[model samples]
Target: MRILCIGDVTSPKGVEHLRQNLWRVRKENGIDFCIVNAENAALITGASVNDAETLLSSGADCLTGGNHTLRNRSVYTYLDDSEYMLRPINFGEGTPGHGYTVLDCNGYKIMVINAMGNINIEPVLDSPYSYIDRVLEREAGKYDFAVLDIHAEATGEKAAIGYAYDGKISVIFGTHTHVPTCDEIILPRGTGYISDIGMCGESGGVLGMNPELVVKAQRSRMPIRFEAASGAPRATGVIFELNESTGKVTSIKRIAF
Candidate 1:
């Protein structure tokens, strides 16, 4: 089976760009399951119901999220209502949506989990390692394969998760930096790992935000209204093949189009 892990979608432009190109990417790459992070889908804050619907209807099989997922209060209902969408698992028990979703496709049961790191993030959550440990104890055996999308700032934490789970999870990819990392490798235990998958928005902008806004905020040390760039939007992600019987990752190829 082939799985595609998409990076963050920063704004409306990102959403529209994906809608226009995602289907073709899926076909060209022979993707069986696709996961997209749409945390910054709502103009650099959070995603909306319409944004999630557009992404799902386009090509995303399951939608994963990061820290900005709950920024939009209007989408709170959709967060609770949609099974295809997910927030961070370490957000704990009372969160509106599930942190992981179990998807059944073509007779294969695949588990996709979303998580956030706390080193440089807010509302300090529980340890992602501990949360995933509990999740595995309860649900890992029942699924044929597992994918962990760790939206984090520190590379060490992301690497730690990959090594901790190793053969336990088929694939582990990081998000939130909006910059694609060069390290894409299959661990010694057959798990696919990448430091970050990059974003699906403007390739010319500063992490999907307009360069002007980012510069203003950085130079002035004041809050600047950040907005998504209107440059040529591009798609970024990774495609990997996994074994059916053992549920181990066999190969991985990065996709940037």
Candidate 2:
């Protein structure tokens, strides 16, 4: 199975780029399933339902999020209704949205799991490591492959999770930092891993926010509202091939264009 995992779509501009380019990219690459992170799609703190629909239309089969998942109050309602959207699995047992989703890509059942990092982030339900172990145990032998999106800030934490799940999962990609890491390799166990896939937005800006505003906030140490950078957009992601029978990754490559 071929899967394309995109990094965070930081803003509407990033979303627009995906809308314009995703289909062609998928077709040219022969991708079977696509996943995107949409935690920062909203103009403000909360995202719009239209954001989710736009990503789906852009060829993403499933959408996942991190701490910003609940920024938009409307997301609470949509989480209950949508099967393709997932919040962090460690957000507790009663979390509105699911933490993992299984979809049929061609004849293979692919499982996608979303987990959040606790270091320097808000306190959530449970530890991400424990949560993932539980999910993998329950879903073992039920799916053809499994992919995890470990949205986190600390690179150490992300790398730890990647190593821990090396053989068990097909692919483990990180997000949230919005800066693409050069590390891209398949683990000894056949799982593909990267520290971060980066963000799809203004490459010239700070992360995906306007550089001027971010500079001001840093220099002045005052509260300043950050806005998405407006300029030539760049898309960032990774593509991987998973073996159906063994549920392991065969090869993985990074894509930034």
Can you give the TM-score per candidate against the true fold?
0.97, 0.95
lDDT by residue (141-165, candidate 2, tens digit) is 7887889999888899999998999
Angstrom error at residue 27, model 2: 0.7
Candidate 1 — number of clashing residue pairs? Answer: 0
For each of the candidates, the C-alpha root-mean-square deviation to the true structure, in angstroms, is 1.1, 1.4
Model 2 TM-score is: 0.95
Alpha-carbon lDDT, every model: 0.89, 0.87
Off by over 4 Å in 2: 44-46, 123-125
Leading candidate by lDDT: 1
lDDT of 1 at 192: 94
Q: What is the lDDT of candidate 1?
A: 0.89
Instruction: Indicate the residue-level lDDT of 217 in model 2.
Output: 100
Candidate 2 colliding pairs: 46-72
